[model samples]
Target: MTSAPVDQQDSLAAWLSIRTTVPWPRWSGERAAAGPPAADGVRDYFTATRGDRDPEGTARVLTALDRALADAQEGRQLNFALLTGWQRYVLHRDPVGFRTLPAFAKGGRERYGLAADTAARFEQCLSQSTQPDLPLPSRAARTYLDVLFFHPFEDGNARAAMLALAFVLACDGACLDQAHPLQVTRWADDADGAADLAVLIGILISATQRRQRHRSPA
Candidate 1:
């Protein structure tokens, strides 16, 4: 994987202040409002299914994420093992794990992630997302963007990114109503993409909070 640009890193750090005040909703209320917190909803967010081409992979991914989210809701911070398990499920055929060579995507034609030799750097990125100083939206968005830019897994990086985002939010007792928007129109090299991603997470935070408030009566 290619190294992240310094300017983009700086921009991401600066964005923590941009949406720090929006309160993260508690999972307890979400469970109450939605009738129960279900991992199936997360699968629904991606329209995940055990189709012929990748049968069982979708179910495995969903099961892994459900366990991850449940752990997060209980106040467990994300770890490499959690993410690796998710990837193993998503790319069940390749459980030996992560790309062993440089990777690239169409948007940024070259050096899209840290070179395959730098597993420690990727672990550091996941570690940083656990820092408490940043707000939920910032942490969640940064983790999502990190997964996008880091491109850690050999396949199903997008699913990993969304799961990273959801795990961060769940750690803070929040969740998004929809996550499909995160799967497209992202540019690893664009500062605006980073900023917009934070904004979108903030929007989802606010929308989810609004729904939860309605679900609870004063």
Candidate 2:
């Protein structure tokens, strides 16, 4: 019998050291940067709320991210997002009720969306949407933009957005987190005091170029 491929959680943990005890860098740490937006006004929040031996034995923050992405894809509206202080929780877009599904992630916060909820509807309607027009790198760029537009989660929107994009690139054997933690943190800190997808797109573009060169055929 053939073994099934590993799920997204394992892959993300493997690449990202999710829920690990590895020596994290002093800087570029979500632990150091949480609560109130940075002075620079990092738009979106990219926090990591690991507990200090707290209740939930092993927090599956990555899993939460996976669910949020899937939920957004499912065209389901969610008003009851889990916005916890632990585990990098911060809503991307806001007020995504079961009735509304707006696009434009951070800026697109609609208290009352059309009964038909177009954005989520469009996402659900898409087929092979994962495949991008540009090379894998550009495709990666688009995913960051699209999810940021969706803004599914109430917290950890950027991290979740980055993870979702990472999953797609990994499908093509390209990983973004290969960039240094400082690099990733730079992008996180660069959130436009609202988690600007455009800034993150720039970061992803640079990382993709590096990854392409690194993985280039010798």
Candidate 3:
């Protein structure tokens, strides 16, 4: 029999429901000690908690993320240098940056990503999203979705996307309580996937705001 269908909206809705009900994970001592949550503080917490998950690459991605956030906060546009720098760190010794060859995901469930030549155009779209016209939550959510669909890097695109989303939030003077929601599996072809993610993003934004309020001293 053919594989059962995936209900993209239902899947995201359920995930969002459960996530919002739970307590946001406790902040690490490093994060708590950072005075106020910022991009570097988030990186510090992420690196401390998660560094061992990919011992060889965590430092690099963390460093690159800090750099990218610094630039993005100044209204700088994303370009090849920023991305390749991140890839170099995430991939370590691997020479590949953007996949010149085709890429696949989860056994090739979705269609191929944009053509290699469209990478510049992809960067343009990403940059445009950061304009003040768009809400930060929408920009962050859309950036995460863009990274999911663009598949910009050969490896570690998911991680990169998480960082990208976090950066967008941090740049807007907010920090997510957790980045785990973006780590869930996704399919580019799902019609409701992008919209659902936007909903999740809004939930995350509100959750983070509450978290900040609760954590702050009176």
Candidate 4:
């Protein structure tokens, strides 16, 4: 008799379990220096990654980014409705909704199983983007991973993740000048990788501020 295929473990659960335990790096409240507005790194990222093959799709993403940034600037809370609004543009669809079935990624190695409370849990996670205790980098990093592991939408989830990351930083008046470095495969269960991402975000924020300072006139 042949053996059956092994069931994939719930990557989402693994992520939620370790989310609060990750050793997020500390930040000293450093922010980007005052100067001429920097080029939109999130726009550049989408353009470079998808513009060649899908110009229309890239345009949609940029439009979504615009809306996300606007909401961030207005101090809007991050939630499913806000995300769905932007996601409609990213996906070029009128009626986008959450994924009802389990989602898989990384060549089917990781699965995000949906429970009745999954969406509620996701919203709770998003709300933490404004958590008072955690520093900006940690909050931003956590929000990014929340989107990644939640795998909320049926499609365009990666784009959604990037938008969420950008929005989280923008909420605090922080903008990264280089988002390319953040494009990497993130495993749901890797606690060290999660913390490393926070460190990387902190570095990018400081680097952007440094460049802005250099460009500013004395």
Local lDDT at 190 for model 4 = 94
For model 3, which pairs clash? none
Reference-based lDDT, residue 148, model 2: 40
As a TM-score, model 3 comes out at 0.70
Q: Is candidate 2 or candidate 3 better by TM-score?
A: 3
Q: Write the per-residue lDDT of candidate 3 for residues 41-153, one digit (tens) a residue.
A: 44654576578786657777777677767766776556556666666666674565665644455655443333545577557756755666555665676677667666767
Candidate 3: C-alpha lDDT = 0.59
Let me know the TM-score candidate 4 reaches against the reference structure.
0.95
Candidate 4 per-residue lDDT over residues 29-87, each given as its tens digit:
57657973477778899999999999999999999999999999899999999999999
In candidate 4, which residue pairs clash?
A: none
Supply every candidate's count of residue pairs whose N, Cα or C atoms clash at under 3 angstroms.
5, 20, 0, 0
Give the distance in Å from residue 98's predicted Cα in candidate 4 to where it truly belongs.
1.2
Q: Which candidate is the best by TM-score?
A: 4
Of 1 and 2, the candidate ranking higher by lDDT = 1
lDDT at residue 80 of model 1 (Cα atoms): 69
In candidate 3, which residue ranges exceed 4 Å CA deviation? 1-35, 38-53, 93-96, 113-116
